[model samples]
Target: MRKALALSLCAVLLGGCASNPADRDISGTWINQVAIDAAAKGGPLREALQAYGPNLEWDVNTKAAQARYTNGFENVEGKLLGEKPGAWAVDFYGSSATELKRDGKQLSQAASENEPEQVFDRAVIPVPEGAPIGASFERALYSAYMGGSWQVVSGNGEGNTVQFQADGQVTGLPGADRYALCLAGDCASMSGGNDSIWLQQGGQGNSWIFARKGKTLEIFQSVNTALADEMPSYTAGDRKWLLEKQ
Candidate 1:
C-alpha cells in the first residue's frame, strides 16, 4: 500500500508539472506609435520608431512585430490602422507611449488586433541645484584629459585653487607654468604650458574648469581633488561642490 501511495504522489506531481508550461502567459504585443508633435511636423516617423527598439517588445501572439519605416506605423504583427482609438502615441525623446483616444472612445479595432501591447517606460533626471548653465564647455574639458581624482589642493577666498592627486594628476592651471586663477566674484582661468583652460564659474562660486585637448574634455573635482577622475562625466556635472552658496 505504501508503494502504491508513493507512486500516486509522484504521478500527481508530474501532472502538475506538465500543466505549468501550458499555463504560462506569453500574451502581449509590441505597441508602437508616433509622437503627436513629430507626426504633425511631417518628419520621418521612422526616426521615432527606431528610438524604441530597446524598450519595446512584442509577445508571440502571432509572430514577431517589426517596426517599419515605410508605412509610418509600429507594424505590430503587420497590421496597419489609422489614428484610431487603441492606437499608441509615442514620444520619441521621452521613450514613452500613450493610448490613442478619439472623442471619448478608444479605437476598438486597433486595440483588439494589438491586444496586450507593451508600453515603453520613460525615465527623467531632474536638474539639481548648482548645475552648470549654457554649454557644458568647462565640464566637457575636464572629462576628456584630466586623469585620476581631482581634489581641491589649495584655494584662496577668491577661487584660484590647485587640485592634485597621488596619481600624478594636475588640473586647473593652464599652460606649462601657468596656474589656475580665480578672482573671487569674477572668472577663473587655467593655462597649461601653452594650452588655455576654459573655466565656468557657477553662480554659487563652485567652478568647473577644463582644458581643451582635441575632442576630449577631462574633468576635475572642484572641492575634492582626491576623488578619482574616473567618475562619470554626468555624475561630475551633477555633483554639488562645496563652494560659496549661490
Candidate 2:
C-alpha cells in the first residue's frame, strides 16, 4: 500500500506518547489530509464536497474536527465521534502537532515535507488489504480517526465555553422546529454566559447549558419535555454528555 510504509514511520515517532487531555489544542477544523487525499479523486476536499466552515461541516467521510496535543498524539478511546475498528485491535495515533491553513481546514502535520512525515497504519484500519482508498476509505478513516479520537476541545481554559457537536444534525427531536434548523448538512450555534440555549425539534423547549473543562466540553440538557432521545442523542452518550473538537 502507498501509505503503509508511511504508517510504520509514524508509529516509531509516536512511541510512548500518551495524550494528556490538558495538552490538546483543537480550536477550528482539522483533517487527516492523508485520509482526505486518499478519498478525493475529483478535487480539493471542500470543493469536491461543496462544504465550508467557520463552524466546520463534515460528513460520514469527512472528520469535522480534531485535537492536536503538544506531543502530536490524539487518543480515541472513549470519544463520541468517529467509530471504526479493525485488525490488531488498534488504538491509532497521529502527530500531536499540526498546522492549519488560514483558509482551508486541512491539517498540515506530518505532511510529506514535515520533519517527521504524517502517516497512519493500514493494519490498524480493519479493512481488506488495499481497499480502494476512495469515498468509503474516507468515511472509514473518519470513523477510525474520530471514533477513537477524544472528547476534548481547545478553549481559553476559562471553563465558561460551550461547544456541542450535533449527533444527527438538528436536535432530531419533536421540538427542534424553532431553534435554528441544525441538520447534518448545515451549521449550528453555541450560546454563552448564564443564558440557556433553547433546543428542541418543535416549538423550542429543551434548554441546554454548556461548559468547558480543560479539554472536555460538557452539555447539560434541561429536558423539560419527553422528546429527549429523539432530540439529537449522542451516538453513544447521555445528556450530561462529554464533547470533543479539533
Q: Count clashing pairs, candidate 2.
A: 21
- Candidate 1 positional error at 79, Å: 13
Q: What is the lDDT of residue 61 in candidate 2?
A: 17
Off by over 4 Å in 2: 1-184, 187-214, 222-239, 242-246
Please provide TM-scores, in order, for all candidate models, with all chains considered together. 0.19, 0.19
lDDT of 1 by residue, 12-114 (tens): 9988777342232222322222222222232222233233321223222213222221112132233222223334332223433334322221121122332
Q: Evaluate all candidate structures by whole-model CA lDDT and list the values in order.
A: 0.29, 0.32
- For candidate 1, the lDDT comes to 0.29
Give the residue spans of candidate 1 off by over 4 A: 17-19, 30-246
lDDT of 1 at 45: 24
Candidate 2 local Cα displacement, residue 227, angstroms? 18
